[model samples]
Target: MTVPFYMCCQYVDGKFCFVLHEWCAKLPLKVQHHVVHPAHTFFLLPKIPSKFFGVFNCNICKLPSNGFAYGCTMCGIYVDINCAFIPKEITHDAHPNHLLSKVKPLVKLTKRNCKACNYPMRFRWGYDCTSCDFYIHLDCALFLPRVTKHKCDEHTLSLRYEPAENHISEYFCEVCEDEFSPWKWFYHCTRCAQSMHTTCVPLILQCEKSRMTYDSGGVYNFLNVKFGGTLEIKGHSHHLTFVQGLESDGRCIKRRYVLELSMIFKCLEFALMDQIDHFDHHHPPSLVHLQQPSNKSEEDDDEDEEKDEDADNFVEEEHHGGKCNMCNEQIWSFHLSYYHCESCL
Candidate 1:
């Protein structure tokens, strides 16, 4: 049998025990030695294909793992390679004074949320400062990148760890169109007025290379063809031309229509419009308008607003009379009404 060069193991009492190679020597000493978690002596263990173990989830992040892990056989405690090397302490721009200590929430009485991102930390491992009620996710504490570029936008985006203190309303990601807490980290392009969630930024930069494979699903080919370009679909007769943000009739398409089309044809190679040339044709092909229908009434809008207000009130009542779940700040009457500290809500 030929053994993979990247894998190394030892025969311990008749059973195979995985061991870290020289590549793992570059990892932090704490993780390598298991000094922080004495009960669980960490070892590099690769995922086994057998059904005996069932599914293994990381104790720290609570996310399922099927890759290289640092684990202990005796206690059955395991953590993914990324979580194993998380720093013990971190200082974020949002909370600079006290070093946020990496900790697992011991109490389950109150719902805990990260102060930096305003995201719930019920089962995830994150950094916290008891003194200031400051908490943040391990990924957020690392401050992944300072700047990034995405194909969705023209200008480069700069990381904004926290919004300005004076700024009030919530911010929404331009790409996903989902609202994100202003207190959390995000990417912003000042010139283009584009803002995206830190999590969403990575998806924009994913490799555009097509995955070529033959399967029963008719030989899927993920194409990265650009707009206004011609591409051949499997069964389509005419070469499909990509046209975005506009109808074939030259009228501006609605934003919602573009978003809907993008979602529906995300992985498919069919074009939104088709252009064909025929010698016998007497006149040019009539352009089709790609307009989205909107029939929302004023009463419906008002009802929606009322429902949102009611939900906000209910949340406030649930967390009222207690400290802010995120920052640990005293939840005054006014603060309780908002369900967050002045810095974040």
Candidate 2:
């Protein structure tokens, strides 16, 4: 990762000169600063490394770059690089009917406040726009529901800007499996009067992706929670099943999902470990095992004793060991299970 450049000021030719610096290595050079009047803005002059100079005013902040320069992509709207990568879209449950878009300068559009959030889409990066004009904060936009499904519920829930008089007022989320008020952004089962929290929807979407490998009925919801049922994708022979489980009511389904995600992570961990082992042949297996995830639970009664023994074994084994090809740590066993530190790896 590159360290951020900083702005600095120095007195030169009886005047304070602004400049961009690498944040370290004190160096200053004299140069002309770009100052756009009418706009009353200041900018750094473009120069190659060979002709580099010191302190210059940042055209964006009206202050020095603390010694570094940042180029803005938005047509001369320069800002520090740190502030450049804002999210473009957000779908918030607070305003279900709309997906929010960030405000863009130089674009003319009528602004409207969110009926649900009472937040103006024109202000603070939130604005309501038609095909003609659109703007809203990224977080505010997330409230809209992109899709709906029924699972262990009754009334059908659809994403709407406002609720109807006869609409079901409360239901449980099939994803988090939690009960919530229907007024909130949620998944509603029209048949059973069921609903799901807005936050639960994204997690449920992940389960859908993973379901592609399983067949209907073959993938059980352990907790007897109902689903929208299985799906048969085009170009595939097998059916896929998924269950949205709310906590408190769908314990079995929750556990199944957790187990599945944990297994996936474990597989990734092993792949990483294998790569490390191949690169460092001389590292002892025991040291590598220390870096690997523990199969035994932390609550195991023997954990403390095992840890003490392992430490003792490591020290003794290193007493007359060959140097590790990676870290300087002593080799403990010939079955090298080298674990790479995240930074080094």
Candidate 3:
């Protein structure tokens, strides 16, 4: 048998206290016989502070904020409800030219790699090209702009690359803020004691192309950049040899680090399903898939044989084995990147 709950109330001075119902009469405390049953046992809790219920958004991830919140509401400041707060400005010696910027949602629908992570920048909120697709997380892109002159003797370093070399770095690039000795086709500034990875140079280019610039030395700098092969890599000196046809491992490292090749193939499948979207706007609508060979391949050894088999299997499955999920047309592996049909995407 369970006991019913009741609440009790007390009255003072002169008149007898009143019980609203029989349940109140049976409460725990019977002060001056005023106690009611389960009703009297109820406890009253103190009111809580309203400030404890404020909100914020995650500074790193940009999720909804919670907990003891304090921010500029007028500027839409917020953070995740349960995350710890971080400082806005970071100080470093390597990047003395400018302070780092904190941001998120660097790019959208990009099938490329991130210069910092050496992986695909997909579905992540991190530091990014304010104007273009280049992106980096706060923790990753953190660097102190160089202040003093570099220790190297060959070049008189400047914060900016010289125009004579076509905007290319004059010395070695320091990856992960490592010590620089000798490297080619890399950017360096002896005067500023600064160096950057060759891959990082592309980031500057993309920023320039997008016409995006941030405050550099109290001036609102623009992305006015040009590129020429002037610097040389220490280990891989041949990097500067084949200008246009350089087989860069950076691309491979990027895909391998982030999304697997299977995902790329999956994206290809999605592309085939929606080939029309990838088509040139000027060209007449022809049900053809434009094939752009992938830059890197994981299964290089079996790629040739597996591709043929996959093509056959795709044809059999799409044409008769299974329905095209996009437009209900029959498709096969041969029709992987480009699917032909009215009903397909």
| Tens-digit per-residue lDDT, 128-188, candidate 2 | 4455343443333432445555443444466533443476654545654445444433444
For each candidate, how many residue pairs have backbone atoms clashing (under 3 Å)? 0, 61, 60
Models 1 onward score TM values of: 0.46, 0.26, 0.21
lDDT of 3: 0.34
lDDT of every predicted structure (CA atoms)? 0.52, 0.38, 0.34
Q: What digit string (tens of lDDT, one per residue) describes model 1 on residues 186-270?
A: 7888888778766556453223211111110111111111234345657656765543221112222333332211211222353
Off by over 4 Å in 1: 1-37, 48-56, 73-75, 108-111, 164-167, 205-345
Reference-based lDDT, residue 193, model 2: 48
**Model 3 CA lDDT for position 312:** 40
Find the 10 residues in a row with the least total lDDT in model 1: 212-221
Candidate 1 local lDDT, residue 283: 37
Q: Determine which window of 10 residues in candidate 2 has minimal summed lDDT.
A: 261-270
